[model samples]
Target chain A: MTDQATADLWPGERTEAARRLLLAAVESFARRGYHATTTRDIATGAGMSPAALYIHYPSKAALLSEISRTGHRATLDLVEGAEAASGEPVEQMRRLVEEFTAWHARGHTVGRIVNNELHALPEDAFAEVAELRIRIEDTVRRIIEKGVARGEFEVPDSRTAARAVTSLGIDVARWYTDRSTESPEELGRRYGVLVLRMLGSAAA
Target chain B: MTDQATADLWPGERTEAARRLLLAAVESFARRGYHATTTRDIATGAGMSPAALYIHYPSKAALLSEISRTGHRATLDLVEGAEAASGEPVEQMRRLVEEFTAWHARGHTVGRIVNNELHALPEDAFAEVAELRIRIEDTVRRIIEKGVARGEFEVPDSRTAARAVTSLGIDVARWYTDRSTESPEELGRRYGVLVLRMLGSAAA
Candidate 1:
């Protein structure tokens, strides 16, 4: 596994073994998808036995839930962090788009599973992740709302505009490849400028 | 299956049984993903035997290839059709975004599979679909180029702009649900306006 992959696992995961299992699950899920990946596959990828896998994660679903929850929380924290960093609405949005888009590009494998594989999550786990998703959306909407209030941006519908911005960032995971010449930071800067134009900010 | 679902199948599929199998594959791939779904599951969904399914599609990969090829072709046609119908660049872009985004929203199940499941296709089939994807991107890029040439749009990088626009539309499939209060047409219109602003269009 690449050091980047190892670093992307939930930093709060206390045990090295559990972090290894989570990284293994992400690789298997990203390669074969959540439904196709088996507990044995994850264990094999991690160089552990299925029985040993149970010590870290009770089931495949639990592993997925933990990944989903951690990924969503990271995204939420990124957006909120960007929001808190800037007093200006345009700068806040730029930071939000830049960091958020870069996060997706950098951790695209985890982002793909977090955004796409939640359907496989158990009900309560799914709900927990859904709540985080809502917060992310609402946070973006609130940013746009503040922009409109300050007359720094013009949008007829804050909700849809927020969705479009978030969608642009989220879909980076769908298509980003290491073969691409652009770095994640470059892609993030490009998207940040485009998003300003998208929001009708004069600063664009 | 719903009438809309049946109608979305490749109309050129000559036999009724072939269309049934194709539709079943789309539904199965969308719900369980391409990797987890089996030919047996597809045949069962279509009310046919596995042996009977082979009479039409040679393999599950074949079914997925046909779906991906057909869906990509339709998108190409849609983008080209919009381009053909408009002489003005701004109008051309509006129509492109509206139709393209609405198509993804309406056929989200097939859209999801066509966009996300192509990784499961055999190498030759994946190459074939990749060619179509490149054409779609090129066509959109050409439209933006025309807009830039006429000074109807101002974008520092047309290629990335095209990518962001297409990304916005394609992602509708990931998040769109019947539960959404916005209809596909309305969502498309909303995106149409947002895309104009994104492109730095004076018409916006």
Candidate 2:
């Protein structure tokens, strides 16, 4: 579970058994929240005992921190992934929103835990997560900047527009799912319209 | 306080004192969040013993419900106040964003508690707050609709843009004031520009 490669992303053992344990932590954290969940519960959710679970991850907080770190990294990566696309700023934003919204819907627990118990982390840990978040924000701002230079979009302040786009996607963690009134694909399509128009995109 | 008169937004008296008590609840809930805060801390923060606090508001959950209700009502009132002004949709949007941003910045704990612990409310209480929120959202949507009808703005979906505006303002609560880097008015003005642009206002 602690493999730094995926350890930072939260898949245990690379083996099936530890992967089950890691997945269990997601369910436990989602339902009970980070502060309320326990190693024992995660173990039981994986059909094991607390002591056995400890062999995979040192403690409950450790498991949470790893999962949260992984989730945050994934979000940053998703936005960065959009940079490879060659298109107008509006098209880039549409792609970013698609990846951003879908990840939160699929990786529900990690996103929820990171957002909810951010205060639980030690100051240094909090700074790490905060830095990761800022990088993502800056990336969005750069995209807006690129769009402005291309005359593909216009914003009063690229920074504030970036924040709006980021918040629009992040808020999905608070409300999104298959059972939700709006499906992930539908949300992506609608958000594409919303975000594109926010940048003065007539075609979007 | 407890005064519901539209003219007397902030009552002064024991009932007005209830507003203070409720504000205390907002601070407690925002700091520790809804699931983590105890009613005792709320009472003590209000300068009353926990037992005395209970006499005014039955439980932590009840306190959360009241603050959320009041917060939503205050938001609706602000929008209504701006709607009464005779102006183009762009002007109306600017004023609404200015006031809404100030309100969110002024009472961040109220915003945080409302957005974060919304699920903690009892069914009936949740329904009440939810209805109030929907009403506020609908009010914003109406402005968008009117603007679209007047050909003053063009949005793919008025409802989606309304949701974007709310999300943008509410985010002020999550990360506002915590950083001493920007004044409330400055943040409000910057966000106002962003929101107006998001609403498809060329003036933004």
Write the residue-wise lDDT of candidate 1 on A101-166 in tens digits.
Answer: 888888888888888987889999999999999999999999999999999999869999999999
Q: Which has the greatest TM-score?
A: 1
TM-score of chain B of each: 0.96, 0.86
For A1-204, candidate 2 gives per-residue lDDT tens digits of 221222345444366657767778877776765666778889998999888888878887776666667678888888888866856667778899887876665554466667777887766667888899999998888888998898888877787778778877777767554466766667677777778777766666
DockQ of 1: 0.89
Question: Which regions in candidate 1 have their CA more than 4 angstroms from the true location?
Answer: A1-6, B1-6
Model 1, B103-138: lDDT tens digits are 888888888888888788889989989999898889
Which pairs clash inside model 1? none
Ten consecutive residues with minimal summed lDDT in candidate 1 chain A?
A: A1-10
Query: Chain A TM-score, candidate 2?
Result: 0.86
- Model 1 chain B poorest 10 in a row by lDDT: B1-10
Each model's iRMS: 0.7, 2.2
Candidate 2 segments exceeding 4 Å error: A1-18, A106-109, B1-21
